[model samples]
Structure formats: C-alpha cells, structure tokens
Target: MATATTTAVFPLLLLFAAAVAVPSSPYLSPTTLFQNYQKMLTNFKIFIYTPAKPFTFQNPAASLFYSSLLNSPFLTQEPTEAHLFLIPFSPETSTRSLARLVRDLRINHPYWNRSLGADHFFVSPTGIDYSADRNALELKKNSVQISVFPVISGKFIPHKDITLPPVNLAARFISAVPENASTSSFLGYLKWDGKTESNFVEELRKDGDFLIDIERELLDPVENVKNSKFCLLFYAGDVAWMVEAMALGCVPVVIVDRPIQDLPLTDVLRWSDLGLLVAARGGAKRLKEVLNDVSEEKYNVMREMASAASKHLVWNEEPQPLDAFHMVIYQLWLRRHTIRYARRESF
Candidate 1:
C-alpha cells in the first residue's frame, strides 16, 4: 500500500470510480409515477435559486443574467434533476445575500456542502469598485463566480471563473454626439478614473493623426462605431464598444499588455485569430504604424472574422448554436466533472 502524497489522488480515484462503479443517483428518485415520468424528461438541466429578488434591474448586469438564464433551454425548477445549481441574487451589498443563501441551502440542501460550493455558481456583473470593502465580497471564499468583470486577484481563478462579455444593446436608440469625423473616429472614454492605467492618449497620438478623434457628444456613438474601418480599443475601461464594433462589421484593434484569456469560448476560438492585438505601452506609442502596417486585404479578412464572431455576442431568447446563451452553458458543461458532490447526500 502506497501513501497518496499528491493532491491529484482523490480526484483521480473519484474519476476512476465514476467510470467503473458509481450507481444511478438516489436523489433523482421520484415520489410517484407522475413525478418519476417528469424526472425522465429533465436532462442536462440547471437549477435556479435566488434567495433575493430575481429581477433586480437596478443592477443591469445581474438583470441580464436572470433574463438570459430564464430564456436558456437548460433551466429547470427541479433540484435533484439539475446538472448545475445557479444561485442568482441581487448583490446590492455583494455578500449578505450570498451568505444567507448559502446558509439556507446548507440547512435545506446537501449539494453545496458536498462540494463546498464548487458545484454552485452565481453571476454578479458589477464587481467594480468592490475594493472599498474587500471583506464583503463572499465569492472570494467559495463558489465559482460568473461576472462581467471578475476580481482576478486574490483567490478568484480567472480560468475556472467565467468572465462574461459586457452587453450594451440598451444604448441601441440614437443619442446626440459632438460630430462624426470624416475619417474613422475613436469613440469611448480615454480618461482612466480608477480601475485602469492613467491617461496616455496624448503620448499615443504623437506619432501621427491617422486615428480620428470624435468627441462622444458630436455624433451617434453607434454610427461612429459602425462607420469606422478600425475601432481604437484600449484595455483601460468601457470595452462595450468592442462588441458593438464587431456587431456593425467594424474591426477592433485591441491595445493591451496581457492576452485576453478570460473571453468566452477561449478554448475553441482564438481572439487574435479574429481581431487585431497590439502589444502593451509600446504598441500604444506606435499605434499609427500598427494600423498602417495592416494590408487592405488582411483588414477585410479581419472584418469577415468580426462578422462571424458577432453572432455569438448577441444573446437571443431562443438559444442558438454558439450564441451567447449556449456559449455560457457550454462552458458550464465543460466544467461539469469538476463539481464534487457526495452522492447528492441524504438530505
């Protein structure tokens, strides 16, 4: 008999047992024939739980998550029949609701404590400005957090946790702008308030005036985004325009230091293969040269890629193949094996 010295031993044993010896889940058993028949239809299901209000429009990101989940094909009311448990809550305080929900679940349900929340997940889109009180964000302690902008530092596992694309279709209706530029104009905030690097636009623009500067007040931001051949996208803040540009068949030139590893379908679809990626601070310095360097033919090819990827950006009520709705579910499906539960234990 050998002593198991590695952390991988337990997982490996569980995997082997699942392949050879695990029985049909007792938790899925029904009370009556009618209930049993209903359970038969529940396959590849997601159980939704919100200890607080499900529809909290004050939190735009959270409201979208609830809407998207409700419309998805995998959603179900039956707990035992679910493959994934979704804990949707109004994270106004960020932790109180989560703490109470977990406590309630632990008392009434055995699923959470079985895996210590690895099987459970929640989506809170507004993780920004959470630095004021880091102790309040309950996600750091347990569970996989699905957020638009996850706090990547601390114990937040970027690879394990889901980083959703920010959807801003509500700004669909036209609004006033300064004036649309003759050339393709950059549209969005350049000032780094708190989250990103300090203002560096003046330094980047010194090389050449290839990129047009259109004050957001002059023209419709949508028109500016659509009309542009190349949209100047920085990692600073307000990246909604990237998806907006893609939806309107405009190519995006992403200027950032690190690779965008947290994007949806990263395992299958490569970001660089679809859009332009310029290096860090130096890339910003030589921004004009980088844009000019792209051949007209390559630009067209990139636009085609953008058009193809745009379909996945838009979420529909009816989940379509590779669309935003299915894409999120697909990521969950890939992680299904990681969910550790003690036989849905005798609760």
Candidate 2:
C-alpha cells in the first residue's frame, strides 16, 4: 500500500519539478493572441464554489462578476474538470471573513491542498491593498487575483494577476473620431474641479491652449470631448476618464503622478500605441512640450488607434467577442500556466 501511494505521488511531483519561464517580450502578435483567445473560449473552464450556506445579500459591484460567470460558457459544475476555482468574494468582504472562508475551503476540499491554490482565483472590483492585511494576504498568495485597479509590482503581480476593465454603459453611445482633423474645434479639453492645486493643470491654464472647464460648466461634456483632438486625463483615484476619453475618440494625455499599469488588457494590447503617458516629474511645461512635439499625422494615427482599442474597454451585458469580459478571461487563461506544475503552451 505504501509503495503504491509513493509511485502515484512521485509522478505528480516530477511534473512540477521545474517552472516554465514566461516570454520576455511584452507585446505578442495580435493574430497569435486572438488565436489563443479563441482556444480559451473553447477549452477554458471555471469552477465557482457553491458555499454550504447562502449569504444574506450580494454586493452590487461583486454581483456583476458573479452574474456574468454564472451566465458564461466557461462555468463548470464539476470541480474535478475545472482549470480554475473562483472564490466569489465581494470587494467589501472583510479580511477576517476572507481568511475564514479560505480556511474552510482548505479543510473541506482536497483540491486546495493538492495545488495549494495555484489554480484558484477571486475577483475584487476595487483591487486589493496587499500591505493592509499581511496575514490574510499571505493565505492566498499563490492564487490569481482579478481586479480593476491592479498596480503592477505593488498590489498586483504581472503575469500572475489580471487587471479587469471597469464597466461603462455610456461607451455604446459614444462616437469615433472623424477622419478629418479639421473637425476638431479645440486642441485639448479637460474638466477640472478648479480646487486641486495641480501644477499640470495650472501650466495648461497658463498656456491657454486647452478648453478647461471648472465644475460642470459645459452643457454637454461628451460633445466637447468629441470635438477635441486630445483629452487631458488626470488619474485622481479613478480610471473612468481613461476609457471615456478613448471611447469618445479623443487621444488621452494621461497625466499620472507615478508609473502604473492601471490600464486593462495591457498584456495583449500595447497602450503606447493608442495614448500618451505624461509623467508628473516634468510638470505642466513638460506636458505642453510633449503634446506640442506630436506631429498632426502622429496625433491622427493615435486618435484612430484609441478608438479601435476602446472596444476592449467596454463591458456589455452579455460578453461580446474581444470585449472586456473576454479580455479578463484571456488574462486568466494565460495565468493558468503560471503555476510550476501547469504545462506552458504557445499561443
């Protein structure tokens, strides 16, 4: 009996002896990426655990993912056939409760102990602050995390975690950029609170080049964005503007205080191809110089690219082909092979 058990476990241990290295190149050919996406749609399967007891209420934000997964083709009832196990935790779920839930999963299941959560995952709308609860964070360190605000190297581990795109229903009504540059009435536009003492905003105000609105002054802000060549987007704890600007066909000059990978589907799409990243190190004058340096031709190209890429940022009721839902799933599929025991396959 001992020899039989040893023989059975030895093969599984040998299979995970070496870890596969991910490709160094950040960008993959779209053709190859989409091909893998198709494969994932066909083959990838997810198992969402059914708790022994039903909760009193479902979180509004977390319910979006839960409902989508429940309706998705990837869901599986049989855990033995699943490639990933999802812990459907709301963003408001307490650290203590989360720890307890994970403990229960381990105690009641063989899968958690078998792989130590290498194939498990959870969705958090507001992203996790890994430093807040070190003990709780350590419990599921090996599991994949899907979030809206995943910060690379900080709260999120690239290649192991997925950055989910926030839902925006308004994207459906937005129009793409006109083929003619002459259609743009303004060089840039920004809706400022007029209170934040941002050096970038002040500099742009001093230059008198951009149409800056204080408060909700504009009759229709969306229309103004459509008429502008570029949108001055400042990331002040919110990412709604990024998708909004892109969807409206306005090339975004994303003014970020620090370097971050907040954009969704970054692994498959090159953000630099669509929008500009203006570092705060240079202040407003630097922003002016960067925007001014762009040729009319380059700006038009980027505007077109932004419009094309915005499709990946929109979340539909039913998951669409190459939309945000598929993008998140693709990211999860890629991470499935990140575990030491999982075999790496080329897309």
Candidate 3:
C-alpha cells in the first residue's frame, strides 16, 4: 500500500517542484533545489489521525484543503513509515476540542511520544491558539502550524510555521478583463469600510493616487479591481481578497502596519516579482512616493508576473499542477529537516 502510494505521488510533486522557476535563495541552483525537492517527494509520508467524526468546515479554504489532503497520495496508514502526523479538524473546532484530540493521540499512539509532535502538523485558516488558555504547550510550541495569516509576532514564527494561501473555491465572478477593456482609471483601488480608521488610512483614502471604493457604495467591487492597475489589500482577518485580486490580473499592493504579514508562498512564489508591498508606518505621503516611483517598465514586469503567479493561489476542485495544495506540500517538504524521529523497536 505504501509502495503504491509512493509511486503515484512522486511524479506529480516532482513536476510541481520542477515547474517552480524561482529559487528561494540566489545561492542555490535550480538543479540543486529540484534534487532536494525530489528527495522530499520520494521519502516524505504523512499519517493523518482519523477524527472521531468527520470534520465539516464552513470556510472554503479549510474545506478544500482538508478534503484534498485526504485524497492526496501523501497519506499513509502505517504510522511507522510516517514523517509527519496530521491532526485533521475544522477551523470552527474549539481549542478545547483540539487539545483533547492531541491528548487522545498522545495516550493512544506511540508516535506522538517519539518526538513530542516535532514531526506533526495541522492546517487552520484562522490559526489554532492553545496558548491563550495555557494548554497544549508542547503541541503549540513544537508542531508545525499551517495558517493563511502569518502575523509578525511570537504567535507566527516565520520559516518555522508555514503559510497557506486563503483560497476561495467559488467560481470567479469576473475571470478575465475583456480585450477591449478601458484603460485603468486609477493607479490603485482600495476597498475600504472605515472599520480600521486611522490618520494614515484616512489620508490614503483621500489621496488622488488611489480610488477608494467605500464598501457601502460598491456596485461592482470586482470591476473596481479589474479597472485598476493595482489592487490595494489591507489584511484584517481573511486574505481571500489577495487571491481574488491576483486572479483578476491586478497587481496587489499589500499594506500592513505592523502585526500582520502579507506574503504567502514565501518559499515557492517570489512576491516582489508579483506585487508591491507598502508598510503603513510611512503613512499616505510615503506610500504615494513609493507607488509613483515605480517606473513604467517595472510596472509592466510586475503585471506580467502577477498574471503568471495567480494560478498558484487558486484552490481547484481537483488539485492541479503547481496549485496551492502542491505548494503547501512543497513548504512542508522544506521543513522536513526539522523533524527529529526517535528510533523504534523492530517487530
């Protein structure tokens, strides 16, 4: 069973990894990265702990990710051969329930005790926090957490914890702009709701460089994005907007003040190549300077890259080559070196 699973999975993953043209590090050759990725594909095995009842997710990102993982060839029923153990649960599942699940795994399975969850991982769009209640410290501290929001805090350790793109599985309302579509009216478009009101945000709203579409006034929100050269994104809780903006062929200008992170697929996709990142700390004046400074030649290059990178953010019904699902697997493969497995007694 493991042999069959291994054989079927490797080629798809290898193809996905090979298709990634951008190297995460300039020092590493593409051939070296591909070789490393091939090794991960051949050896990495995941053991998903069966839940007492099947999980039902309300969030599309969580639903698609969990379901796709179950059907993927990385799954192995044999615990002894597993490199990572996945604790499957819905995003709506309470922290208490999640902690209980971990406790059950610790008591029932010998694997959890081997490395104390150093090789374990879980996927949550909103993220799991056992720290607030002062519970499951081992799992919280040791296990790899894959979340859509990778905040710049102690809560989300970059490179240690993984980032998953918040994928909207629904069919796009506007897939592509028409060939004869009108030229962009504004340099950038921001969908604002006045929820997070600040001097900087308000200043940006009135700036001539951007077209601020107040949420209540939006007739066609997607169209606003399509008609703009750049789509402004401010991360509140969800990042589905980032994916949407990318799919619409709009270059994303991710704005975050401090706590939040805007980059997804840090290892797989070159974010700088696709879009511009503006730190909100500089306020509207600085932001305008940065956006205006972008040369016409540079903007064209980013627009082209954004179009190509858009497919990687979408969650297809069936996992496709170099899609979000395969990219997460690649990230996990990169972090596989952190796993310290204990020697087991032979039967």
Error of 2 at 130 (Å): 3.7
Model 2: weakest 10-residue lDDT segment is 16-25
Across 257-276, the per-residue lDDT of candidate 1 in tens digits comes to: 76655655453344665677
Give me the runs in candidate 1 sitting further than 4 Å from their true place: 1-43, 50-61, 94-97, 128-142, 149-156, 170-199, 204-209, 212-215, 220-227, 293-298, 316-321, 339-347
CA lDDT for candidate 2: 0.67
Higher-scoring candidate on TM-score, 1 or 3? 3
Encode model 3's per-residue lDDT on 115-182: one tens digit a residue: 77778888776665644432256666677888765443555756567777776654234455333223
Per-residue lDDT of candidate 2, residues 1-347 (tens digit): 22333344354334222212222122345556745655676778889888645542243324555677778878888998888888776466777877777777878888776666778888765556543343355434667877664343466766576777656678756655455654787778887877654666777777666788777588998878888888886655344666777877788777776776757787776677677888767877777788878888777777766776677777777655666776777788887765533312100
lDDT of 1 at 61: 45
lDDT of each: 0.53, 0.67, 0.68
Candidates in order, TM-scores: namely 0.66, 0.81, 0.79
Give me the candidate number with maximum TM-score: 2
CA deviation > 4 Å runs, candidate 2: 1-28, 52-62, 131-135, 138-140, 150-153, 194-199, 340-347
Give the worst 10-residue stretch by lDDT in candidate 1.
Answer: 21-30
Q: Which residue pairs show backbone clashes in model 3? A: none
How many clashes (backbone atoms < 3 Å, residues ≥3 apart in a chain or on different chains) does model 1 have?
Answer: 8
Top lDDT: which candidate number? 3
* Cand. 1 TM to true fold: 0.66
